[model samples]
Target: MASDPVTLNEFLTERLGAGGVVDDPNDLLRYITDWAGDHRGKPLLVARPRTTEEVAEIVAHCHCHGIPMVAQGGHTGLVGGAQPDAERPELVISLERLSRIREIDPLNFTISVDAGCVLQSVKDAAMEHDCDFPLSLGAQGSCQIGGNVSTNAGGLNVLRHGMMRQLVLGLEVVLPDGRVWNAMHALHKDNRGYDIKQLFIGAEGTLGIVTGAVLKLTPRAQATRTALVAVPDVAAALALYGQARRSCCDLLSAFELIPRACLELAFEAAPDLPDPFDTVYPVYVLLEVAASGSVDLDAMIEHLFEHGTTAGMVLDGVLAGSDAQAERLWQIRERMVEGQQLRGEHLRTDIALPISSLGDFFHTASRAMAARSPETMVIAYGHIGDGNLHFNLLPPADLDLAAKKTLLHDLEAALFSLVDDYHGSISAEHGIGRVKQTSFLNGLDATERELFEGIKALFDPDELMAAGRILPRTR
Candidate 1:
């Protein structure tokens, strides 16, 4: 007299009609994993809800049945946040059907969109009204707005526009117990107690499912200037960054640092990408300035170049004369990730420290990594202006599979230890999804760890939403 497994197909078909549930193994296979291809989890059924009411019904049904559920958006998360554990019979609630731009309030400088709306679509919708959605990334075409909100994603424009948290004005979420909290409103200042929208922004869907959002918009940039400047060293890079900050002020949209090794890899990976400088420098910076009003951006860039040249802060520079040229310059910066991948197995670390401590952090981490594994290839680059660095360590070319794993483990431990020494974060833009769950526990102390658990409990008492993600299980 064993109980039968829940007939998820029948359940979904009955509740949402045959169109809502997809039981085909081929279709389900794609939703079972994440962008990183690290986690492979299967679900009893993949449920696609078209409306908020449908989502509410599905969540409520799963809650009543004590069935574990995972909410998935574009599945572009780097930390395996959207992956489900195949060992368990889980239900994947796909937001693909919920894709829609509900409203655009240009007067309020906000756009209301369903959680399933792709990031690029939102940006396009904003542009339709002559407004701009400041939050953007390389995955703009694939990643969804709900996923961005869930991770509080930061991108190239963070120096000017801030993170996803800043752009989100309000949210509509479905609680675990089946109640819908419709807080979707475009309000600049609301003294409402608690500001519940903040709870779900970076919560990674652990608390509740984000159904929709009211996002802030900005005026489209009328003028933009991009430059690829070569610095003498890390110190000079920091100096030039300070000068740019002072001169350009708020117009300074991006200031990214790229190591020579990263550029080499980019050139290797992308055969068409041209080198900006005539000579290969130790470090190169991709800087951009955007203004809403009429301004001589080229003159401002020329002034910065002249100053840098005089001070020896910059050895050489190139300014993009056209939009195509600007995109070409940006391609070198954006392809850093793809370029690093060509090197083979590597342990990537996205850690952030104070801007003042970046040089020391890099020196110490590089030394520590070299001492541990002299042959390891280190590819380091990132948003130097905001102090976030991507310190990626590649396995030695001569090492075997087993040896490489050991090296990777040691490298991660040493790098994370150095990050801790600087009182920096282990994961910066990427949320603490499954990939960093262990790191999260290891990084936090007793008090901080307890507080994290308390917050999770406060939001999701049943621990049903995206379980085994940000928090570690108590043994």
Candidate 2:
């Protein structure tokens, strides 16, 4: 029941005027596809709304016409959640023009911003006000604040700070039926009612469109230290992490576990990068400690490494002497991704387990990967402090695209089957977008599925908002 071609033209002309609607095919192409160039779709039209009223108007019009709509922000998501449907007549509503930082309260320790404000810009704004925004990610330069909230993103600082969920104090959302919900309380204590803002935080636009948010800010980190460590195995890495926590006390900020194979790939990708240690160990850890007080953080970090070496937990290590050296060490970690992209046709899994189960799960998952196929090489690296691992499988040199495609099912099943035994989630930071929807649904129990369905129906009865991305739609 989408509006007819003539009706659509008339609606745009009357409601949005000239600059609001984009009709050029080339411009349309940018909104249709994802940033990764993997998934592409065709949108009936792309609407750029400059204000909240404009968004509500578009949503209400689409609802009246019985047309589906997909809300997009930044479009840097790895999962195909932002991509609209090509077969159906769906409207793609881009919030890019709504970029604005409305308020930054220093005393309240909050910053309220429009959905389209880029993540790095928010951080810069907070820093300018002599505060800090702790939610940091590699895509912080381009990813929007709305997308970060939608995914409830977890990054390197989650050990000290929390995920995007914990940072958001309140949200201003436009519901599926075009009714607005303004919950921008920006208060630390609001216990009178249910936490309604929680629903829209990680819903990924299935229920409503997040137009604005109030995020908590923190005092800027004063003293900082980083180190590249070598551990015997996952068990040693866990032990070292515990020691690091006790040594650094409240200052331990990041503890990442990196496999030896992943390091080799980084070296291969970046020849200028020098190895931190003379002896190559099976595992390495990139650990950091930051303090807001006047603590000698570098000395404390060095002491932690020395004690680790004495306890036989660390084989070798190097503490970053200067800020430039620390940045270089991080560059190696960032370049590991490019190293991965150079190797084609990889199966990447973003997963989490209980902190206690990490060691056992890591060993078991490695054995499982080996049993499934010797051709697939395992490269594991992630924020071990929070029990999340990016366990990636590299395809064999001889396997072609068609053959790799055939093994995709077994590969995914073999990995996810471990989740059942370890009481872990199939996805940790990444939401169940179009790419993971089928597997996600299959892994859920009857009660969980029913609950999720009820929530979806209650908010979006017609399921017109980003239909088939997180949940399937009925004809």
Clashing pairs in 2: none
Model 2 lDDT per residue over 205-290, tens place = 99889899999999888877888998999999999988988888778989999888988888888989988888888999999988
After superposition, the stretches of candidate 1 with alpha carbons farther than 4 Å from their true spots are: 1-6
What's model 1's lDDT at 419?
91
lDDT of 1 by residue, 1-475 (tens): 1112346667788888888887888888889876656579977678899999999998888777777788899988888888776566568888988999999998889999999999999999998998899886888899999999999999888888889989999899998877899999899899978888998988888888899999999988888899999998888998999999998856999999998988888788788998877798999899999988988888889999999999999999988999999999888877768777666667877888999999888888899989988889888888888888989888878888789878898789878888999999988898888777877888779999888889888766777778888896432
Q: What is the TM-score of candidate 1?
A: 0.96
lDDT of model number 2: 0.86
The C-alpha lDDT values of all candidates are 0.86, 0.86
All candidates: TM-score: 0.96, 0.96
